[model samples]
Target: MLKDIVDVLADPVDGTPLRCADDLSRLVSESGHSYDVARQGYVTLAGGRGLNHEGDSAEMVTARELFLSQGHFAPFVEAVTERVAEVIDKSHAPEPVVLEVGAGTGYYLSHTLDSIDGSRGVGMDISVPAAKLLAKAHPRVGAVVADAWEGLPLLDASVDALTVIFAPRNPAEFARVLRDDAEAVILLADQGHLDELREPLGILGVKSGKLERMMRQAEGYLELVGDAELLEFPIRLDRASIAAQVGMSPSARHVEAGVLRERLARLPEFMDVTARAQLVRMRKS
Candidate 1:
C-alpha cells in the first residue's frame, strides 16, 4: 500500500511531491530525486547524507513485538486509539491520514487505524527491522524509514492525527507536517512506571516531570488542547514477559546480556508491576 500515502510523501532532500514510478518499484520526486521501494514493501526516504542515528536494533524491535503482542500495554494503546478516533471524527476529513512517529512494529498505529474508518497510517521509523514489521503490520499502513528527530518526510500540513508513544519528538517538524486543525497525541512514561521491576532487575527507572518538560519544549510549535490524562495499571508478568519488557527498552542497552539474564532469573516466577503513563493532546500552533 505504498501508493496509499503517495500524495503525502515528499522528497526527503527537497520536500517535493513524489510519484510511484517504474511500475511502482520506485518513488520519483519532482526535483529529480528517486527512492527505491524495498521488496519487503517499505521505503527509506532519508536525505542526501542519510540518517544520523539508528532508531532501534533488530533485537529490540523483536522484543517489542513480543511484549506488545501480549497486551501488557492495552490501556495505553486504548487511550491513544480513542484519542485518534476523536480527532478523526471531529475533523470530518473523509480520507484521514494518521502518522505515528517511531512507529516500532506498528502496533499502536495499526490499532488506531482499525478504530477509525477509512483512515491510513504512516509508520515512520529509522530501523530496517522495524520497517520490515511495519510494512505488514496492517494493510493500510505505508512504512517509511527516516529519523524522527530530523525533518519528517511528509508534505506541509498533510497529516490529520499524529501519535508518539515513548518516541523521539521534533516539535518544529511536527508543526510543519500537521494541519492547523490536526492533533498530536503523545504518551509519556511518568514517575513510577515499571518501578517494581527496576530494583530487582536493575533496569532503568522513569524520570519525574517528563510531561512538564515536554510541554515546555513544545512552547511555540504546539499548544495543549485538553487536560492531560493519567493512566496507571498493574500487570502480572512472568519471567519471559519481564525479560521482553527490559529487552525492548533503553535498559536493554545499559545491561549486559548475560548479566541481565542472571538478574532476571533471580526474580519471582510472576510479579505484579505497574505500567503508568500520561496522555496529552496538542494542536499545531
Candidate 2:
C-alpha cells in the first residue's frame, strides 16, 4: 500500500514530501501537487515532462514472472539479498529503506524485503503493468511509475541500499538519494551469459567494455567496494522454459512468432544452459 512507504516517497516535480490524502485515494505533496492513486493500488509519479520511456510490456512482464517463478535465477536473487542485508546492517538503519530502480514485477525487491527485517522497498518502474504487479508483490513495497532517466522520485539521502538487477542505472541520482555510507548493488549480464541460447535464439549479446563504461559513468558518483563478483550457474531448462526466457528478452521483438517457433522446435527437449552475470558492489563517494 502507498501508506506503507509514503515517508520515503517524494514529489516527482519538486522533491517535496508526500502523504496520502482524501482517505488514501491520493497522495498530496507538500508543494500542493496531488497524484491520484489508482484503484488497483499503485501511483504514477511522473514529473512535468512526463515519462518518456516505455518499460516492459504486460506480455514481457508476464514472461518474466513465469521464468522467475520457477526459481531459475535463485542464485542471482540470493546474491542481491545477501549484499543488501550487509549494507543495511552496516548502516545500522532502524528502518532500512531499499529501492529498486526499473523494478520489473518487483520480484527481486520482494525477495530482498522478505529476507531483511524492518525493511521496506520502493519499486519504481515506467510501466503501468509493472506497477500493478509491484503493488502486490510484497506488503512493504510501494509501487511507483516514473522515468528513471529523468531522475528518481525519491528524497535525498533516504535510501540505505539500492539494487538494480538487469535494469537501468542512474548513478548520480543514486548517489544523491543514498546516504554517504549507503551501498548500491548492481548486476550486469556478462559476455557469456546465456551463450547457449544466443546463437539459436538470435538474441543480443553482451557488449564488450561494459564494466569499463559503467565505471566511467559512475566516476564521480560511486566507487567499487572491492572486486566484481561473478555469479555463474547452470540450469536445466525445458523447451517451454527456454521459450519463456527468449520471450522476456529483446529476442522476442527481433524474430517472427512462427519462425521463432520453428527454431525452438529444433532444439533439444532439455538443455543445460549457463546463466552467468557479474555482481558489483559500490558505495556512495
Candidate 3:
C-alpha cells in the first residue's frame, strides 16, 4: 500500500523524494535521509527532532473506530465523498491522489477512495495508533505519521484533493502541496453541534466565529471556493455510542473517566444527538 502513494511522499527533513529501500523495510530519500517503516505497515516521516505531538492516543483511536464503524457520521462522510468526486471530475486527473490530514482511523479517506475509481490516498496523521489502523483501512491508502504543524511530509503540488475533517490545518502548507485547480474540503464542528450532550456530559462547547477565524488564518494562501455549507443531522445514539463519541473527542482529555461514566449512567439509554458541521471548499490562491 505504501507503494501506491510513494511518489507523493517526501523527506520530512529536506523535502526530497523518497522511495522504498531494503526491501520496503525503510524509506530512503533522494537527499539520503532514511526513515524506517514500522512492522505494522506504516511509516513515520519526522525530521531529526522527531514528532512534536502525539496526535491521538490508542484509546482515542479505538473509540473513534468503534463510533465511526457504527455509521454515526455517515452524512459527514457522504458529503465529503460527494464533494471530492466533484473536484476530481473537474480536475480530470487520471490517477488522483487524495490526502487526509489528521486522518484518524482512515475512515474518511478510505470511504472517499472507494467512491472514486483509480484513486490513491495518503492517510497522514501524527498518531502512531491511528496510523496502524490507517495502514490496513484500505488497499489503495498509504499511512504516514507526520506532524502537520511543522510541515507535511509531502512534495509540493503533489496532492490533487485534500480533506481535513475536524482536524488541524496549515493553510500555507496546504496551498503549497495542492496542485492548481485542486481543492481542500474541510469540515469543522459548528457551535451547538452536540448541545444535547454538552450539558449532560459536562463537555466543552464550540464557539462562534470559527469560520471567520479560519479564513483569516488562510489569507493569501488559500481562498474559499464557495459559500460554506452547513450540514446538520440527528443521530440516535445509545449510551455506549455516546460514550465512544465523547471518548474520541477533545472532551475525553478534559473529563475524568470515572466522572464521565457516572454522568453517562444518569442519561437515558437512547437519546437523539445533533451532529452539525460546516464544510468549506478551498483552493490555492
Kindly indicate the candidate among 1 and 2 with the higher lDDT.
1
Q: How do the residues 222-255 of candidate 2 rate in per-residue lDDT, one tens digit apiece?
A: 9999999989999999998998998888779988
Ranking of predictions according to lDDT: 3, 1, 2
- Model 1: which ten-residue window has the lowest total lDDT? 197-206
Error of 3 at 113 (Å): 0.4
Model 3 alpha-carbon drift over 4 Å, by segment:
none
Q: Candidate 2 — which pairs collide?
A: none
Kindly indicate the candidate among 2 and 3 with the higher TM-score. 3
Q: Ten-residue segment with the worst summed lDDT in candidate 2?
A: 201-210
lDDT-superior candidate, 2 or 3: 3
Clash-forming residue pairs, model 3? none
Q: Candidate 1's residue-wise lDDT over 76-189, tens digit each?
A: 999999999999898999989999999999999999999888999999999999999999999999999999877899999999999999998888899999998899999999
What is the Å distance of residue 27 in model 2 from its true position?
0.8
The most accurate candidate by lDDT is 3
Tell me the tens digit of each residue's lDDT in model 3 across 1-285.
Answer: 898899999999999999999998999999899999999999999998998889899999999999999999999999999999999999999999999999999999999999999999999999999999999999999999999999999999999999999999999999999999899999999998988999999999889988999999999999999899999999999999999999999998888989999999999999998999999999999
Residue pairs whose backbone atoms clash in candidate 1: none
* Candidate 3 lDDT score at position 66: 98
TM-score-sorted candidate list, best first: 3, 1, 2
